[model samples]
Target: MRAGLATLVLLALAGYVFLHYQTGGARAPECVVTGTGTGEPYRLQPQQAANAATIQAVASSRGLPERAVTIALATAMQESSLRNIDYGDRDSLGLFQQRPSMGWGSEEEIMDPVYAAGQFYDHLVQIPGYTTMPLTEAAQMVQRSAFPDEYAKHEPQAAMLTAALTGRAAASLYCTSAMDPAPGDPGEIRGRLAHEFGDAVRTDHSGRDITVEVPEPELSPQGWEVAHWAVAHAAEFGVERIVHRDRVWEARRSVKGWQAAREQDTADGLLITVAP
Candidate 1:
């Protein structure tokens, strides 16, 4: 009787494995940000990835260092979990939970991720040596949250995101969706990219193919920075494939992450092929 029960259990477990592979393999469509070494990778939904990318983009636009990006990300993670939330403590709103009553901005401006991140950095840079300050202290100086210690918990995850979003980690960010979404609008993608990155990014689109090339990113970190941004936004933008130098990521095959490109194109900074 014991031997028969053991066989029955094995059969049940096998059935569960089959069901899971057949139905649960899609994984709910999310993006992952990884750092160097053996650190655990952090996962984020597409919307969260978009907000995090915006925070980093704003810092890059101001030519701020990576430390500024790290601080802003930690504060946002604590305040809104990197989401552009509409409700918050009292009148606080948006990614950084900036309160309009506190003169952060009008509600509409505060809701805009780019504007919110810019405001955070504007105050952050004014603090004496914020870059070198402890993560919680730097954030508290700008935020003044009731729980000044809350931001510290998010520092490690924020730094991991900073590395991927800032191009310090290459091919370290990717998204997986169930299937490709409908054909995406190149115009909308271009406009949103401009809204976040400003003049720092330039794209020339022919048909559904958009070439995102930065100026000599070899000397700058903007190459993979923009590349990873494209990957993070892939699900939202209906991006079908992305090519950066020797690496390639396809939406359908993104489960494999960034694979080696069959033909390397190191000259062009990045080639993004949206849904046709």
Candidate 2:
């Protein structure tokens, strides 16, 4: 009887171990990538990826972070796959497919990807806890979609896109423009960054077409925040190289350029060197 009882005890222990291994020892849902890509899987088409660039540009222009951009992209992906469609559940139209009767905007503006994205971000930022909440929850609050849970399905891909577009991660983003020539002129990139970071930016007469120098601020919480913001906007400036503390981060494009190293100067200032 003693030996039989001991065997039962060992069997129970094994079962527990198996269950723990299978479930990661908690009831938390496993992080699953649900689409085609190897990392941060999403179900958007090539055109949608281009639309995402427009969305990122709009968010960057508003001084919003990658998190906000991600939320907007996820919301749009669930709503219209980033396409500026002219139809919706009723009279809805455009990228958001917002109903004009609902006070969204005129049909022409709604179909404009940049305008649509900007309006979406505007509404999203006004939410009380949007910045800290889960992407799906924050998006639902703004969209108030009847199928609220559908937004959750796009989080993985949205995260991947944000990390790549914001330069937080390397080579995680790519897109094909609607026109082979690319939609917006590259000059708009610099203009938008300047608008967000401020007119304090300085230019060198060295004939380097697209570079700006930002004075390192005294080390403080605000300084760090601004420095981080500059780094985040690096992609918007067509910056492919950043030089600070004798280190360089270079990429073939602005999105790739964001991997540059961040160095803190002795004066409590953070120097953000970027490639134009």
Candidate 3:
């Protein structure tokens, strides 16, 4: 009887271990969706979506890959649904729900989505072997969640959001906010670009918008610099279109003939299309 009982116990233990390994030692139910089941198309709140774009732009400016962006987005989605809310578990606050009491920063600084996301990424990149691990494990390592495995469930949607926002895959990230155009200061834009890409920047003014063109040799090295600068100044200049070689990118503004094909390598250099 004792021998038979021992055999059964061993088999049970083996089965449990197998199941644990198979499920990556995390509970499967933790990742299950619990939100509304209405199959209607749902959009994120305007400010939340804008915050996602800002995070993506900041990450891209740092030259981080799409995976990092996805991880950051997923973490943010899980935390605050990409909203820069001013509350969370205990004293935790901001987009990542980081506690200001825990050396993250002051309450106001932590509430800033860009600052919070940047700090989160700064810490995330430090985890050893984080890139190779599963998304849930990596995120869990960073967040130490009570339900550690839940972060995995958001990976697919997070990947889609990152692609859409980063301009990696072709998809529009639209927001329904009222159009408020702010013409960016040309001098500031030029000074910033010159600081980043040296003095290779050429400046021109077309109506109310200022187009800053960079040289061809600097294009490869300075693409991100220019791209980030443009995105940062997007709200300003009521930026209608961003035209690079063979690609004409449009933003929210009234732009007529802004999509014209470009064959003129004008004296300035490569064309950077902006709007009034």
lDDT winner: 1
CA lDDT of each candidate?
A: 0.87, 0.57, 0.59
How much lDDT does candidate 2 score?
0.57
Off by over 4 Å in 2: 1-44, 175-276
Give the Cα-based TM-score of candidate 3 against the true structure.
0.60
Rank ordering of all candidates by lDDT, starting from the highest:
1, 3, 2
- Deviation from native of the Cα of residue 16 in model 1, angstroms: 7.5
What is every candidate's alpha-carbon RMSD to the true fold? Answer: 3.3, 13.8, 18.3
lDDT of 1 by residue, 87-192 (tens): 9999999999999999999999999999999999989999998988899999999999999999999999999999999988888998876566668888888888
lDDT tens string, model 3, 61-123? Answer: 566777887888888889988778877899989878898778889998888666787788888
Each prediction's total of clashing residue pairs, residues at least 3 apart in sequence or on different chains, is 0, 1, 3
Model 1, runs deviating above 4 Å = 1-25, 217-219, 264-267
Reference-based TM-score of each model: 0.90, 0.54, 0.60
Model 1: which residue pairs collide?
A: none
Comparing 1 and 2 on TM-score, the stronger one: 1
Where model 3 places Cα greater than 4 Å from the true spot, the runs are 1-45, 170-207, 210-238, 246-276
